[model samples]
Target: MRRPRSPSFQVTPKGERLDSHFISSLSRPFYLLLAITTASLVAGVWRWQASPSMHGAIAFVMIWATLDLLFLLAALGVLYEKPQRRSEPRAWLDEELVLWVEGRPFRARASDGSRLGIGVDIGFSELDAATRQRALDLFHKAAIVTLRFADGKVLQARIENRQWGPRQQHLHLGLAYRFANIQDERYAVDLAFGDSARLQENLDRRHQGKSILGALAHIAVLAVIEGSKNLWWQLRNLWDLAYGAMGRTLRHGKTKELT
Candidate 1:
């Protein structure tokens, strides 16, 4: 007689994939660069228009507006592109143990003599006091967990407890702590609630006692740059509108489209 193969579940990456904090942290730098580039381009165009042989200020303004419109369209295209989907097959989950996987809820009980184990302790009691506390803290705050089993299979799951409350928290905490302390390369626990790089950067900032102050400065700078950009665009639009009206008036019932 042949042995039966264990049933496998599919693992999919889903829900809130982007780290907002990471994006927020970079906003200041992004706006600063944009402001510098826009200013440089405007200065260059103004200098060119100042030359006696070049087109008038109106034409220069129109040229800059055209460039701005093109840039906006390109940005929209990139922003609205379809998001890529990634998934892993043959990822097994013990439904009884996992409250939810990747934000989707499901329930299942382990079958008799099944090899599938969920949240089973590898060795939590053996860890030292400080390491144990760190693991506990990690689990308590964890929204996502990556688990590796003894057989070298990897499982990534999102934790959600709707009914069990503190019991559920304790269960997951024990499992996560145990897995985190595992020494073997084959079995591991990885928790992700925020971007790792951002977290490290924040830690570094805190060590230097500049985290809060730096964040406030970034927001202030971003606000000023963005406000200036918006005001410039509004003025440009008004000028273009007036220019169009003037051209139509001069042409006597004929109008030209500005590209």
Candidate 2:
């Protein structure tokens, strides 16, 4: 008689899933933006001292404050832009053992009876050619799914990596939920690949919309900053001219009085 295999040896969602490291990658830029704001404020104040005029002081304060505010707001945008937690190759499995033991995690379903995260670990090795194509089609349906944690906080998760290369054989992904119950069960998805080829042109084409929007946003921000550079320089130059003329006049007046 054939022996029953241990469930852990098989590719199953029940195994300990790896942790996602995307958040760590994002922290550096987030903190750098904050540091830039602080530095700009200090430098702006130092430069403001050179003016010594009432209007210059006001302008310095205003511009300095504005830049600092812009930096801060931009930093906040970066800081708030938390990467959605999910399982990837190095993904995290929420292990609040107590929560699972206590049954405290909340899970709901869509209008259809499909459980929020209830998934079956179907392997590529098991499927025939026709079924394999169908599986790949469903992988193409992968999307960035958003979920709310037990605390009601929301998070985003990418079902498929947009940058996945054509040469890749199988699909790897992470599922993340914000404020997940530490005790909730961890899941895994395994796709066995018999043949690896670039799936289709349409899969790659589907992401162009997001890419275009991101590009447009970057261009808009760049245009604003580039347009303002000359204006800032002109105001700065006018301040210096006024201050220099005043100092020269005072020196001349003092010399005449002494003579």
Candidate 3:
């Protein structure tokens, strides 16, 4: 199999080294539809202003607001979604390790934004203890990141501080799609939960789903605020017009009485 050339990325011959979490592809059509809806609403707004139709402006506002919300839900679904990994439809692990040497699985350059991690697939339980220990040594030397599977292949690597309070640490790895022969078997791996503080972090994550979800929540709030502003401004304009007419009537009546 042709090996991957980058340190942070591992490419299986059959499986794609997907950058997206899981069902990230599902939102493409959703976002596209939203974009179209948003554009149409904008065009309608312009036409409404030129034609001075209250009904047309109201229709545009309603359509734009509803579709914007639907788009939010779609974004949340796609970004935070994760699929079963082992059942991933790729047949790359059937062959035994050709050479399990202690080396960078792939070459990586250090970037300023985030710390890079090295990913190593550990499916060699059949190998002796010495070899297993040696395989782990490569991860230690460069202070690179690794995803150590009990028998699971290299899934993915991420940029993390790799600290778990005073002693243990958390591993930030990417999810991989491994194709297994057994059709009935489900692909799942238990992720570790760390210290009390880390436990809180995990709990928060569980409630909110993931980082992507948190971001989505923030975005949704902003959109709501903006939509509220649009509705409020329309109401304000009507109120001002009503008050102006009332004041004009009172002044006209007083002038007529004086005359």
Per-residue lDDT tens digits for candidate 2, residues 1-259, read 2555633355676434343312223435534664575577667666667555665665756676665555444433443323432332231122111111022222332110011232212234445778556655655674645544344434334443422324333333333332244433222121111112322332355444557667756655643463234234444767999999999999999999999
What is the TM-score of candidate 1? 0.20
Q: For model 2, what is the alpha-carbon lDDT of residue 176?
A: 36
Residue-wise C-alpha lDDT for candidate 3, range 90-124, written one tens digit per residue: 21121122222244442222111111122223343
TM-score of each: 0.20, 0.21, 0.28
Deviation of model 3 at 154, angstroms:
24
Tens digits of lDDT, candidate 1, 123-178: 23445778556645555565765544334445554443212224232232212222
- The per-residue C-alpha lDDT of model 1 at residue 155 equals 56
Candidates arranged by TM-score, highest first: 3, 2, 1
lDDT of 2 at 88: 28
Clashes of 3: 4
Candidate 2, lDDT over the whole model: 0.42
| lDDT measured at residue 142 in model 2 versus the true structure, 0 to 100 | 49
